[model samples]
Target: MNTIYRLLLVTLFFVSQNNQAQKRIALFNQKDLKGWYAFGEEKGKTNNADELFSVENNMIRMFGPKAGYLMSEQSFRNFELTVEYRWNTDVNVVRKNNNKNSGVMYLVPAETPDILWPKGIQFQIKEGATGDFVFLQETTLNINGTKTTPGKSVVSKRFADAEKPIGEWNQLVIISKNGVITQKLNGKTVNQGTESSVTEGRILLQYEGFPIDFRKVNIKKSK
Candidate 1:
């Protein structure tokens, strides 16, 4: 009995160590876009791109002079991603929408062209509708016990609004494991889906013609 109890203690120690090993590291170094690039509709990607996306005060500032996505240099899978963002309405000289819009896109396949909207899962970032999931380019996800059709956008009308006031920081957590995905804003699981058609690919921060700031872009692998 003594030996069995000792073995069980050893097992628990290993389990705790393993959980600590799966550390959530900051993707943004708070210095520069070292491991990211830009792709957009115009004046971006495979051209002399302007500073539509820049790093300021340890936060990623999307000027949105041109609409585009700041693509990560690496692809990810089976991970939990967290980011803090706020609308910089103070810097917007030409705010496109009164309801400001942007998004965090994941599982963007590299084979597809970098159009305005590539095939991936988008956690839509918008006013009064921040937690909506936008399936782009025929992407699919099962939500609310119903299998969403290809190229369909399922509105999370049932989820409660979890966004902070404008200009205040809002934390968005996205967890994708196996084929299941969950979107949480301000600590609320506002949207979730299963059996996603997309499982692993690159991530993007959309610059949808609105000044925004993102910080603490961190990620950890999910079990």
Candidate 2:
């Protein structure tokens, strides 16, 4: 190949990569929880604890007992999300097992009492299992056009290095695109999977009987 031709080809490749990386698809507003909706009621009335969902000293506090979920009003299909979370109160009962702790469920269909619409997946958020991926509502997803169950687990073994001490901030990043999902905690890739189908769904924060805080919730488009 000629020198000029090779140089031109390399430049074109670089430009294409840059454009793909620069695409900003999803983002969470840091000022307030204007784009989020809270679920559940206390004492037969909807709980409007603004302090529970508001920013205090630059941190997002999520506190409430029972089964309430703070969900994003907007739905999404494929994007990369970044959130930093920490627990306000350290209680061992909440993080005892996989089922009783707080988690970030994304790509979830509108939820109902009888029929839960995870039709998506979840990024596990707990003390020891911060970056685990669990199937929630996705019946199926596609990886390179191959159909498969969405809730399948790619990393059944726990990666124990990502968790931070209670009351300290831990970083979480989730990348979902074309049925492929990846979760990172504290700069390490902990979980990844591919689904059989894709659907638009909202993000839900779980209420696992303890108080947890989220400092940052941000998302962006992926290439």
Candidate 3:
């Protein structure tokens, strides 16, 4: 190849690789709630009250005496996110007659008002259903080639129950690109969808009347 043509080809190759490369970010610094905010369903933003959430020993502990969520202050798009979580038995959910329920909500538009459940797509982390895609607040996600309309959600048919036994950490990874998204548990891709209505927004870690522990909140995105 000619010298000039060789240089042009090398430049194009580097540019393509850079666009495909992902930039890593540590969402949770593990020392304190630096880049996050806490919102309560009843009172709106509490900035993570003492009784609602706490950070210690490189872990975030959520005490769900009520309904609220620890939300990321910044928005993201076309990224892969990973978080480790486990149900905290410190709070007896059965004694309170509540199912062990919590979730990771993403694509929450900044303009949307924060309520009991904000507008986003939720990776449902229930006892039986771990990888279900819940379109919250009329948010739509097309799964299995079918598009969801307002007030709809898609239960992952192939969503394997990869939830580790209670008290054991479960790794959850979510990838959102363009309009497509995938939900994974452990190392398995449990659910995926395309054509999300909300393309970019902030993320939320829910405290839905249940105690949960989280660690290693991180994300990688294309530049």
What tens-digit string does per-residue lDDT give for candidate 1 at 19-107? Answer: 96587877889888877878867665743222556787999887645678788777888899999999998853555445588989998
Specify the highest-lDDT model's number: 3
Model 1 poorest ten-residue lDDT run: 43-52
Q: List the global CA lDDT of all models.
A: 0.82, 0.62, 0.83
lDDT of 2: 0.62
Give per-model CA RMSD. 3.6, 6.6, 3.6
Candidate 1 residue spans exceeding 4 A from truth: 1-21, 46-50, 91-99, 152-158
lDDT of each residue in 1-223, candidate 3, tens digit only: 6999999999999987886566578999999988898887666887654445789789998874567888899999888999999988874532222678889999999988878688898999888888888887788878788887688454445456688898899999999999899899999999998999999999899887767889999999864
Per model, state how many residue pairs clash: 0, 14, 0
Question: Across residues 1-223, which tens digit of lDDT does each residue of candidate 2 receive?
Answer: 6999999999999999888765654334556666666665443222343534555676556554445556777776777888888776645433323343678878777653312223456677765666665665435543335555445343233354578787778888888887677778888887665653445567776656567777567767554
In candidate 1 the C-alpha lDDT for residue 199 amounts to 95
Q: After superposition, how far is residue 29 of candidate 3 from its true place, in Å?
A: 0.3
- Provide the TM-score for each candidate, comma-separated: 0.85, 0.69, 0.86
lDDT at residue 47 of model 2 (Cα atoms): 38
- Candidate closer to the true structure by lDDT (higher is better), 1 or 3: 3
